[model samples]
Target: MPVFGLHIRILGVALAAFVVVAEVAYADPTPDFFVLLERAKAAPRISAGEAEVAAAEARALQAEVGPNPSLSLEVENFGGKGLYQGTDASETTLSIGQLLELGGKREARIAAASLEAQAVRAQQTRNTSDFAAELAVAYARAEASAELAKLTAEAVGLAEGDAKTTRALVDSGREAELRFVQASAELARVRAELVQARAAEASAFARLTAFAGSKTPFDSIAVSLLSREPRATAVAGGTAPAVAVAQAESRAASAKVTIEERRWIPDITITGGVRSFASTDETAVVAGLSIPLPLFDQNRGGSAAARSEALAASLRLERAQSEADADRRAALAGLAAASQFLSAQLEVERASAEAYRLAQVGYEAGRVPLLELASVRRSLIETRRQTINIRLARVAAEAEAARVTGRLPFGE
Candidate 1:
């Protein structure tokens, strides 16, 4: 065969070997991130938050309804010695009283309740974002752990191969027994590491499954890096759930102040009835109105308390906005740092992998020492581990950014 053909065949064989190794390492397919997040929404915490929002909406709708008219029946001047002693001499009155709200009190109450409902909805949004963030982090952790385990498994394979070669050389008197012992020790160490890596992977998967509210065991997680925009542009300026909730609370508080002030308007109760006089067999229509006078307390304490609450709500809104801005900045910074580090780690991984390959080839030809080959293999493993960790961190930071900016990741 020509040299070029030999090189092509060798490359094809290497590629085929890599595919087989990868397939053997991970026989199970990984689940998508969005699917995991959707499952996470079924978690009990998130469901409880949804229920709270629904209850708040119901209350808000109830606030829009007016008070029901009250019906009363009375027998006036009854049981008196002369005119009301018996049923024949008694006057009976049956009436319905409708309380009419003044000073926009009904509107104010509805407005306050509506704002409160909005705040609850915002709280639900925040809860959803929090759940997404939790799932993202857990998914990343599971993915990283699995990848690390795979790398460790590969390392163990290399160490086993090295040990076999060392044993053969020792048996043939080409190498010392000490070298064989060292190679065997390397294999044992790598096997132990592989076991630990697998345990960590299992623990991470357990956490992901628990967070996702899944009963089935997940074999692996498939993670893809999100295409991020510029930091300043990507950090959305829209109202985050926390900030929206705070703002809605402030508006609701202001509405409550109006409601308290309107409390002094004194609702008028219009009573209309039919009066029956039993003795004369006469019936007459009667109408009356009642209003409470604001003599001692015209809702002065209520109004003052509402005003103070409104001020507190306003301050809380300001704080929420400030914290959201700070969170955005911090998440963006973490993403930038992790991305940069991941870029460097990629270069290191490529270089270390090639160098380890060359060292392995040299060791097979007796040109490189076994110790040198083992060191190169360890370096390659570390590089791969670091790369996985950095990728995990970058993904986590992106998820946090989406959460803080009220941008649901994966269009969720």
Candidate 2:
């Protein structure tokens, strides 16, 4: 009987230690930065990389202008029949000419390409900004989930302890069997919820790992980096998003119009050749000039098309500006609302602290049973979860605000 009593004491001590360890763990949840770092690694997709490459290509496009001059050599007279056949006689001639843009064609083409390159660069910036914003939001969500999971796990642990104590009381004729059953059911529910939370955390971490692609598990994130990258997102969200591209396309369209207008003039092609006959040993040189008469195709259609595109580009630029303004307003609203909610949530948490203390006192005095104590404890854990959510919401809202305002939270 003494040995059995000793075994019972050891078991009780182990259970008590387990509870203490769980509470300690819940008090401060470790961050999962490894998940977020993974997200950052794969943030920019292949499509965005292609956009950057296209911008680079546009810069290179400026080098591609009118075609280079063509050259050729011939000995025609010697290969000709009868009169033209002069195997021993020859005449050599050389001529060179280049096609130049008569109007502002070349200059316009270069300007348009340069503008297009700028627009592509802006697109790249926009993409990167979006990547950072997404990362911040996801990081907030994961933190919230982890904290909530820890809270829920603690609730389940408390509920399990209550179940064992209530079962013992019921066997001793102190508590009813029904009360023991109720406690068990509550413990099961909390356990189920904790399982679900763990699953959610895993999913969140998977996504974070995919994007950040880092080896470090999160102890904490630079709340500043995750807080908001205002300036960067704002630049992307600003008129710069599509402006460069629009300007480039517009310039290109204008260049096309200019090229078409130049067609109203004409092109002058000069050709020259020399001939020889071997039998008569005769040699002669001939030269001629050719020009096209624009009696019908005056490039009227091409010029009209070019003008229409430029007009379309102007409209698109205006639309992009309007969208950016709307986005900024929405982001600001989110940030303000989140801040307000976080403050209110903290007040609610203070109210719960007193309730928790009273409930614990009542339970020890035996005025309130284990079940009641478990209920109040669960409520406290849930309230803490609410606080975590509120903070996460604030973090997310701040990130969005940063995205819109184009300012980092470094100073503010």
Candidate 3:
């Protein structure tokens, strides 16, 4: 073949390959609910919580270490005049001193630090659960938006068909020009609505992908989460993450009080050394002990403050438990109501769909007016929209219940 002909053939082959690849990519299935949840776990906020837990654990380890010993050297009577001057009258001592913690101070400190670490871990758990619940709600919204977009697209198709039929009737002198105008207007309106619904669907998917820490936006989900029956039906009886966090904090505060109560017991420092006398060229062993007297600073105010904080923590823990219980009950009730509403709406949607079919048939047969057909179509669309909303509401309630019960919104 000529050079120009060969170039054209190569370009055509490349274009064909590109088309095939695009088709395969478009046919790829979207990620499922569990995959999205796993992606969410890798979000920055969740990673930050994990880092906090690790930091708390490191601090707990540091608390287990005791105070270090000190080494000191002292020289006296070396720079004075006459009898106290020069090296002949000098005295030197070298010593090692260690502070001995008293009244179980070290033990109390370790306990308090350990309890604080536990509190941090509990808080991290709460953060993860809360984020998961939020992600679940976002997923439901995205799925609902996609469904709405599909429904509106179908409505547009129906409107287009009605417009075409009316145009034909007008041309045949069977329908008035006003009827054709109305049909064209309805088609335009539904097309506009379809455009808006598609935009909303894209926005919802983008938000969902961002929440999941995904760099690539998802075009659609593998399944409709709102359409699936929620699996979280068990009563919320377990200790919620919020309650667990509060309980850990309260225990940590009580441990702090114990540490403060023991603070008044002074630590003892024991020193052992060798003393050298330059005047007689002699060396002697020496030992000493020191303790600080609690004359003014006995930690009385500190103990009182710790007690107050502990009391406050206890109250907070009580409130958290009560609130968790109440929230769980409310979530369960809301889920029940939403499920009932969804069931009733589904029935209405079915009946309305059948009514629209009959209206279309009657209108084509010249037995029904154009206005009546339009009204029936509007009713069907509204019923379908309400059903989608109710399904989303049910999913939200399920997610809330799962959050309060310290469980994943979907099954493991």
Candidate 4:
């Protein structure tokens, strides 16, 4: 397939799972995390990376092509002494010469260029995976921020009601003025927190939008902040992009080494044409061959550099594989930890909500002080915020794990 066709196919597959933001048709009116990833793939950074891959492919195609033949015209002996002074005394020749590559140089050139293109493609794939992971994390943070803002609004409302009740009780001489002052202060503090929470939500949304390079406003996300645990069978197999890119570079370097070594075999140029002797009115066929001597400058330096580069590439490949393995193990452990932490936060939030509800009832019945009720309410809000944060953390960990293992949230 053509290079442009390959680029189009790659972009299509990357963006296929999600609809464009302007064209969203979901019944629930919520966008998935994959949708954010789709947008991210269209971001400037990703497009530029893919463009580099296409350029590399184009260069490889150029490398596969042979050199063009040269056409030559010669008027030998025309400017020489007595006998060659006139045009009739000169012999004119017209010929075409083609350079023939020896020692498999053409094949080596093609192989080197092709392998370099492959390496570029591998790096592009790795970049996409990393960008996708970043998008997922940003989306999670935005959604969690929204949730926290909502919870904060709820706390503000509850604090306002408590302040009003405390004020009424103080006016009726049923509660101390100091208690009412404390309640007013708590209400003011909660109101200020609500403002901060909203600002945080806006900041998160801005980050998500910028990262995805979308002009459309992201009001809400539909993806679950607490994703299900990844199964062992879902881990991606074969070499990941990091390892594959290194291996390709090694192979490409090896091909370059071969190309440099082939420099020892000089290129041959074969020429054929017709020569005309004007004075005798005679025309004859002429054929010639030319080859350079490799006595000096036989590309020894280039060969040594290529060989060293190949060795370095081989070592990098090994290191990349080792790092990928270590990253995979670490990501899996983090995912498990985040999952357990989210579950614990959920339980704590549920218990806090119940306690706050009971505290409100007891306060209304005069069995609980206004201070205690206010304390429970703050605890509940804090727990709710923590729960949202933990859920976001779990989703981020899941994304990172998938990225490290070369797995997609949706099957690749």
lDDT of candidates 1 onward, in order: 0.80, 0.61, 0.84, 0.78
lDDT of 1 at 96: 96
Candidates in order, TM-scores: namely: 0.86, 0.75, 0.91, 0.88
Off by over 4 Å in 2: 1-47, 50-61, 64-66, 89-93, 164-173, 213-291, 369-375, 406-412
Judged by TM-score relative to the true structure, which candidate is superior, 2 or 3? 3
lDDT of 1: 0.80
Ranking by lDDT: 3, 1, 4, 2
Per-residue error for 355 in candidate 1, Å, reads: 2.3
Q: Is candidate 2 or candidate 4 better by lDDT?
A: 4
Report the lDDT tens digits of candidate 4 across residue range 241-272: 68877888888888889988887888999999
What are the C-alpha RMSDs, in order, of all predicted structures?
A: 8.9, 8.2, 8.5, 11.2
Ranking, TM-score, top scorer first: 3, 4, 1, 2
Give the 10-residue window scoring lowest on summed lDDT in candidate 1. 223-232
Minimum summed lDDT over a 10-residue window in model 4 is located at: 21-30
User: On a 0 to 100 scale, what is the lDDT of residue 88 in model 1?
Assistant: 77
Pick by lDDT: which candidate is best? 3
